[model samples]
Target: MPPPGTFTILLFGPAQDRAGSGQVTVQARVECTCGELLRALGEQHPALAFALPAARLAVNHALVAPDHRPRPDDEIALIALVDGG
Candidate 1:
């Protein structure tokens, strides 16, 4: 199990490629907003820095705004824009 205040963020598409994995664990306060979480991810994974601005955060299968607060138990996923036809 992850330590308290740690969140396992699921990665998709370019996010997974940049992160070099399907998921990542981030440490944050229990009441952190999605915006804060995004910042943390970028700081922890420099490869994701450039792609993060265009990414959207999903909490518990639902797209949330930057101000949305996420709980420890909530499922978090980072959705980056995909390019293709």
Candidate 2:
């Protein structure tokens, strides 16, 4: 479980559009993985529901695998997929 008083997250590209900012801070309830955090965020922000499927998450700038645990102060970034040529 997260020790106390801290949670971290970042938003980029179109994910930032949904969050309306490039950075976000949330209070952590229990120590969890990046996926859990994303789920929670989606719950808190319904507008993010649609974006979740296409979004990518990173922990401390490194892409997090599906079950990667999140540290209390881990810098998480949500990236929205973009396509172009």
Candidate 3:
């Protein structure tokens, strides 16, 4: 499990391209919600701002809504939306 007030962040596909990394950790209050995480990521990493709101927040491999609150040890991931013809 990660340290208190921190959560693992997994970035996939376009999110990875934007973040320049596939994995990261975010520090926040224990009550942090998915939307808060999304906003924090965008504020901290400008490159990811455009893709953040559209990205999917997943915990423990399950997709979650923006309002979903993350728990300790939960595997957090951001799956970017993709579009192709």
**TM-score of each predicted structure versus truth:** 0.90, 0.76, 0.82
Candidate 2 lDDT over 1-85, as tens digits, reads 5457356567666767877877766654656767777887787767667778977687787887867877776677776676668
- Following a full C-alpha superposition, what root-mean-square deviation does model 2 have from the true structure? 3.0
Off by over 4 Å in 2: 1-6
Q: Order the candidates by TM-score, highest first — what do you get?
A: 1, 3, 2
lDDT of 2: 0.72
| Candidate 1 lDDT score relative to the true structure | 0.87
Best by lDDT: 1
Tell me how far the alpha carbon of residue 30 in candidate 1 is from the true structure, in angstroms, after superposition.
1.3
lDDT of 3 by residue, 1-85 (tens): 5678787788877778767899777777889899888877777678877787668788898989888999858888887777768
Clashing pairs in 3: none
lDDT of candidates 1 onward, in order: 0.87, 0.72, 0.80
Report residue 15 deviation for candidate 1 (angstroms).
1.5
Q: Please provide, for model 1 over 1-85, each residue's C-alpha lDDT reduced to its tens digit, 9 standing for 90 to 100.
A: 7777898899888778877899998888878899999999888888888778788789999999999999888999987886869
Among all windows of 10 consecutive residues in model 1, the one with the lowest summed lDDT is 44-53
